[model samples]
Target: MKARIFVTLKGGVLDPQGRAIHHALEGLGFGGVNDVRAGKLIELDLADGTSDEDIDAMCRKLLANTVIENYRIEKAA
Candidate 1:
């Protein structure tokens, strides 16, 4: 089983790093750059029968900062 986690900043959070990245992209002549936010991706290969509840626990404990971001889990065969 494969688990893909997407961790992203919640709305209304200030992301200075993302802003800097956006500016750099603009300086490089990338057009149409509007807004930017940074996030994380975690891929886990686990044994079958791993529960969604357990995965949610993992995200809450270590994979994401609940104060600033939210996480979503995707399971793949």
Candidate 2:
């Protein structure tokens, strides 16, 4: 089984890295980009029958910082 975790900063949080990317895009003559936000994608290979609760625990405990970030989990065969 495969699990994909998407982690991103919540709204109203400052994103220096994202800002930098946006600025660079502008410098490169790209236009019409109103905003940019950066995020993380983590892929996990797990044993079959891994419970969703266990996956949620992994996200809460170590995969994501719940205070400033939000995470979404997607399972794949």
* Alpha carbon lDDT at 41, candidate 2: 100
Tens-place lDDT digits, model 2, residues 1-77 = 99999999999999999999999999999999999999999999999999999999999999999999999999999
The TM-scores of all predictions, comma-separated, are 0.93, 0.97
Q: Give the per-residue lDDT of model 1 (tens digit) for 1-77.
A: 99999999999999898999999999999989899998889999988999999999999999998998999999999
Predict model 1's lDDT versus the native: 0.94
| Candidate 2 clashes between residue pairs 3 or more apart in a chain or in different chains | none
TM-score quality measure for candidate 1 = 0.93
Instruction: Name the lDDT value of residue 73 in candidate 1.
Output: 95
